[model samples]
Target chain A: MEKEIKHLKYFKVECFKGLESVELNDIAQFNIVLGDNNVGKTSVLEALLFDEHPFTLLRRFYSMMSFKGLSSNEAKDYYNSLEFFFSNEKDDKVITYTVSYNQLQKNEFQFSIVDTNGMTEENIDNLKNNTLVDLSQLPNTIVLIKLNGMTNFYTTDINLYRQKKSAEISYQPFIKSGLSYDNDLVQFFSSTVNNDLKLRKEFISNLHFLSDEIAEITIDSTTVPNNPILMVLFNNNKRPIPLFMMGNGTIRMVRLILEIMMCKDNRLMIDEIDDGLHFSKMKKAWGIVLEVAKKYNTQLFITTHNSECLKMFKEVLEDERFEKIQKDVMVYNLFKNSENKVLNVDYSFKEFENAIENNIEIRG
Target chain B: MPIKIQLFVEGKSDKKFISDYLDHLGLNDVEIIPLKGKGEVKNIPAPRLEKNQLQGVKNGVIIDADKDKEESLKELKKYANFNLFDEIFFFPNDRDPGALEVVLENCMSSTKKQDFEHCWFQYESCLDNFPQGFRGPFAKSKVYAYLESVSPVLHSKFQGIDKVDFKDSSNWDLNVSYLDPLKMFLTKL
Candidate 1:
């Protein structure tokens, strides 16, 4: 019997000049996508989330590639040829992406067509509205986010208790020296300003495991309370360290934590699983994520460029500590064909172990 | 897999004292659960814990501070929610546990004598006639050192001790540490 997948949707994309075809097939309860760079990992997701048609994509591509000097007719010809090469239609591409239930019973169930062109602001608004339409009532809804080109802004805006206000804003000078007061009012604001209050409250109240973990974090309001810190103490320290103080891996973990905590829905999509993380901390971090996912019934979809993370992930899932969380975990190795089309194979534990034994590069 | 024994010490002194004492007794399996004040043990509500809450399932042995054994036990009982646990123990010192160490000098074995002396409070350090360190079972040598290093304070008012014993009249205004006294319950296992 196949595992029960929470989300039954799948996505596919194709183009001429770039990649011929890219597809993310077999939507599992929780799945990981592993591939090399330019293997159309991000492209598959982008096409799924934002693809409209070849011309529409070509317009964006033309702007990005700075083909401004060319006439519109030339550009249109280039796009037309590109679409024809990839698609059966002259102006269209035969991009094939499939959404399938992991379980055998629902082999051919198809939901509403979610066009990839919805990447535009107007489309995003529509998509978000549509996504939220029955979200308040849906039992097993999936929410996907492809985190690419997401820059982390290191803002040092001070929330001072008694600083004089200036309407004129200077970005450089203002950013360097920021200050915040430590008083009762500031304390109240700092503690209560979480973005998702209802979800946060429920998570706090319902999960019994959090109390033990919360006991470990001590925030010192005096030194830097309002700074919004995420500190990863390799050793014990009194002062609350901010996330900026730690390495990228630590920051990534913090990002993962914040996202997981704020996600109102059960499904999450993390594009790259091992970006900026230390090899040593990957297993432990995966352990934490798996634990939280199980406790909250979260379904995770992740892409990875780290073979070590994948290997460790497999090892941990096999461990007894991960038994409860491993029920529906799936792994897929996505690769591009000679024709520059992407395809995937359901990665088995034995195959992963063999890959490790044979010294295959697990990370993309 | 091991029978977890959680020992709630009144203060750092009690923790070190009891830890060393038990180590001497070859009871290595015990865990000293520190309490912030004499009142913290009162908060653990009694109930059959669901599986999720069972992550912290070590047995609780609350060691509360008191000037008199009877009064302190009564106060401690009021806080120990019935389902919290039943193995709470109380200690009302004639003076601070540091001073109490001096009182128990003959009781501790010769091998453990050094450990006891390191934790005792001197009578000169009393806030009033009562040993000032004992005024807060929380402020003796070992306890003070543990807390100071972990969460330090700047220019503590109880540098030596308070001169006024508000326990008598309560005529003058009383200023206690207004911070969450239950913060001690947040200690990592």
Candidate 2:
């Protein structure tokens, strides 16, 4: 199997947010993060951005900080610009992070927060578009540099983000959304499903879990084929309804399906992975997720506060097919120390199920 | 986190009896997990707590020492696995010339015990050739008969057979010599 891009084998963060010196060892292909509220489950996902510049990471981090909605324009305030760092103030604040190839077999570069010396509207525009903007060129913008890759997202000009979006790469992210506008998600969703048979088939099969009446998925007649607005066709209805007309559970499922099918050699991170699905269908949803994710070789990281979700995931992974790759799946239960920082406990598959069956309250 | 203990008992009756005994001994943080039946306990693995969760969490099972103690112990041993169960105890003390009801019978007052014997003799005399080799110790039937002789009306209140107090409320007490080993062993855990 030829991996198109280097996968993250291990990660460690020091002096970043409430997470101080957090380290995850032997990370799996399919990983899950569980903890109580505000334990930084989403923050940890944001930290694993794998971006070339800090600004893109910053934009993502800021959007995430606002809980998936741009409820605030703190990104525009220079005084609060650096508040994203630990302690919400950046006076000589520097966050150091390291990524390694599988157990740190090969060391990855160090990216630091540097002074913003130069400022230009175009540079900011390019960063927003996830295009290559040289950190060296923008001596003014917060940037990340790879020690061995030689060129940063700014220099080598590789907008893997944009390239992924265009090439249907899976690095799709479903950050928190609280009645917020998501231009990228909205844009990607509307344009990608037109005349896509494979996508429709996958959507139909996955949608059946939510409603047996869903017979078809297609673009709304109001929208032309070229500029498609996706819709769902129920078995009993003569006319199809716009996909958004359905509940959040339907939307979450379709979004997840699209990401799984589109991403190859990429990854996905979802917050509250089990928000709307019933507990009975949770195991089925995971089966589809595992099937499609593996079909595309997509690495997945999701966070859940639901125990039934974890229990079902363990049920699906119990198949002998997942036995060898069971090592590729990991479960982490996050806890807060007395100092009010996050820490985690990793359980092997067997032990995890054991804990759940015994009702030990691992989630809290 | 403080240590947690899980007990896989045969059924609710075993749980009720053992829990009451544990309560009398002043133990805390012990959870009774009823497997619903002895067969389930035999089929299911003992709850092996993770050492990483804390330093001293422990788990085990409590089951009946049904007639034929040797065979019962043999089957119970099948549920035992290394590192899964730190302890295993048979009801009415590890010794099994009797069951939990035997312990209940022992805890009765001297006068009640004599009356219980008389009721047992009368009930046996009324039987036309009881089941072959039925020497004695029909624990359950004898207790019910003795209670009925004590009060036919209050016998109607014998809701849970496992919780029947052989003596009136003021004289209630478990026979320590009959219960000490199991109690001491549990408290130590």
Candidate 3:
């Protein structure tokens, strides 16, 4: 028999954003992170977006900045946005992220910003103009990505990197807080869910929590030339309406379900998972997420501050219907120690249930 | 202002008893947290202590010395980080192999104590010759019988140990020496 390969068995972040250093061991398939405001709950998810390929890793990093409303089309604004990923307190200006799939395989990603003033003019011109520049000679405010013993660099100016071809490999999906429906949803629906009958049925069934009237979902590229809109067809004779016309909760759930389905055999991270979700629908939403993620073999890392969301997660995991996956779920409470270092306090299913039932303050 | 001291107890009854005791000591800063039962005391306190320590709050736990006194204390220390807590005291004077009921029994007034002794003696004598042997941890029953003997109508109306006021001098003497150890622990907090 072959040994099972967990997606991420252990994770560690050092000097990334607000996290001075943090480590999570024995990572479960479904992890729920809880913390007070500004405790680096989202940073943990961002740190896990690293990849062995530098281009894919950089694309994910740019996407995260864009999601946080920090991405900019202007050169200076983009340079400023990149600074948020590094720590201000450290002089070295290097951020390290490491993850292990199992005991035998460990991957580390190191990112550092360099200044071009110390380098020769030829090296600076090459870094600014060329697609593949020498790693030894870097330009001003450029980020050098080191992964799997390979080195690649990207200029801080957004216009420079925009000319480079996009990475062909797909990275893990990170569904950020307050996420709105975008073109990615339409692309995923058409490329993955639309072609698969089983996935299409599962998607529609999950949407019944929003409205049982949703009979089918289709793409409406003809309604608007050169642009595609997701339309929901109702069970009644009423005409189809655009998916965006629905409530924020409905749109958010669709994006979440689509990403989970698309990221099969990969990890998916969602920050503030209960942003647009109502307390009443939380349990059902969790049920769909857990069931779908398990079916697709997608590991999950979700963060939330809402106590009601935590309660719902507890209730869903405790249900006998989810008993087989109960042991795979874990809750982690992130808090800062006296020295301002972020620490993780993880609880297994039994421990988390105990804390919730007894009203213990596990969300620090 | 945030509470500076937190004390974890076993259940609501224990919460009520400890709250009243803290009031008698005039300690206003201590917050009492009641868990489901002894099982939670072993599991819940460490995480809570870690959280509280982050906020610079002092933590302590007072659990019942059920079955064995030293073993209970040892188990608590084994599960929870010992150095994180300011104090860890067991109920019933922190020395005996008993529970809160033992402390309540000792706090009974002289007249009620005599009545409790007579009542417990008769009850034990009645069960002595029974076919089903009464393996006894009858301290709780003794305390209930003592309360009923004091005021049967009032005791009948009470639902749980928490409802019985320990401050009433006619039923209980709050200044009893058995509670001195617990009082000293609170004063330190």
Candidate 4:
């Protein structure tokens, strides 16, 4: 089944991390969110992933916390920090989010703690009652989790519903800076390419922007179809290197480029688009980014702390070739204030250029 | 992003001084952007001021009322909408066309200003070997001479005045009488 949803034009999230009832609007095809550290930039991406089963994403969230060097107990406490995800209401039993494709269609989901103290029949019943969208037909998901502090125990459950009809959405891809380190890229690339030789070629060619030394990138077909390893052939070295040994910048860029190419008419969310690439390659990389995004009509939501990235992105997106379609690219600065409320400062392309010229510290 | 106001200044010194003054006036969230010179202000990026982009952020530009006040204002008007700002000030409050240095000289103690004048007159009286109308800018030369008279080390060691903070209210005995217009405008902002 496919989704009719192509562009996630808007999002409103409440009671998720530090973002308290934050609303992001006028979302362009290619969006850049700029802000200081710990200002809810990542939370925005997490909110978009609300359609995914929360239990499946628990490891993703747990890894996000544990990688920061939290101990076992600290990681558990952090995971159970309902107050962190709780919106400002005195008793925030529910956290809700919605990602809209347009005026008529959207995916909305919510998680409520009917048994934060302990998992009860009432708790499971609450999730069943509050299932906002028909999951199977509407491309929606809901996860219910409970933590019992007295016994230091926790339980997570995932539910998939039978929808009356299945809705068709193009595709939606989400990437964080840590994707490569999570050992998920190899299988991701393998399955994304599937058995299509053309997709395999397209993926490899895009990665050539990172290094011309690679002759080609191919998946090992002899391995299991669902979990195939990637191999790269360099021009000078006859010995082809497996993609598993690929380092930071290479894997990150590969995943990003492949997703953009394969997703076609989908939406792509990248947490930090400027990571691992050299400062010198910023302009060229952005040029490629603009070319492909415009070509495939992929809506992008990318975040960055580097002003140069923003500047280069503007330079490429407004080039004569793409200038006619420049309205699709927008820059926004997200800020979280003391009350945990989030606000965004929207910058038109012209304003973004002026802000860069004026050296305004938009990121800070 | 909630920057209540933004001040575009001529260069580093103006940026530093005005930033401190804004702090002193308790408009701490305001941003002061240092520009290369008067030319950039005249160009001013030219974005529509009435647009939503700058709706809440009041924008102001401070330029030297250099040589031709009318010409300076005219060029600025080409880019900025004067009505959009709460206040926009020119340096040297009572000026026959001058820059930031002239404004700082106005901030000096009255007795020091007189001494600076006396020193300038002494130097002028001895310049009999120069051509007619050969004198340099009085405002700039006088301020440098004042610094020299007060402390020879400051005159010799100071590479330039662009980074000095003349608007630091606590340490600077700025002639508030001379500063009234700028001070009033800043306080309102």
For model 3 chain B, where is the 10-residue window of minimal lDDT? B149-158
Q: Report the Cα lDDT for residue A269, model 4.
A: 77
Best by TM-score: 3
For each candidate in the order shown, give its overall lDDT on alpha carbons. Answer: 0.42, 0.61, 0.78, 0.63
Task: Select the stronger candidate by DockQ from 2 and 4.
Answer: 4
Candidate 1: docking tier = incorrect
Q: Name the Cα RMSD for model 3.
A: 5.3
Q: Per-residue CA lDDT of candidate 2, range A131-190, in tens?
A: 345243443435444444442443322233223334233323544523222344445554
- The residue pairs that clash in candidate 2, if any, are A68-A176, A116-A140, A117-A140, A118-A140, A133-A154, A134-A154, A170-A263
Backbone N/Cα/C clashes per model:
22, 7, 0, 6
Candidate order by DockQ, highest to lowest? 3, 4, 2, 1
How would you encode candidate 4's per-residue C-alpha lDDT over A58-94 as one tens digit per residue? Answer: 4434434443454244423543653455655637556
Instruction: Output the number of the lDDT-best candidate.
Output: 3
lDDT of 3 by residue, A164-259 (tens): 342223334888788777776787788777878987998888677557888999999998988899999999947898988888888988888788
lDDT of 1 at B156: 72
Tell me the spans in candidate 3 whose CA falls farther than 4 Å from its real position. A1-6, A119-138, A148-172, A180-184, A195-202, A205-214, A222-228, A236-238, B1-6, B26-31, B45-59, B66-87, B105-175, B187-189
Tens digits of per-residue lDDT, candidate 1, B1-189, equal 332455555455556555544444345666665555444444322321111024244545545444555666566656534344535444423223223232222233333334433544443244345543434443345433422332324477343212212222122111222211211222322
Off by over 4 Å in 1: A1-6, A9-11, A14-19, A47-90, A93-239, A264-266, A324-327, A357-364, B1-189
**Reference-based TM-score of each model:** 0.38, 0.67, 0.80, 0.70
Fnat values, one per model, are: 0.00, 0.00, 0.33, 0.12
Candidate 3 per-residue lDDT, tens place, B7-81, comes to 888899888888887777778888888899987776673566777777677888889998888999777777746
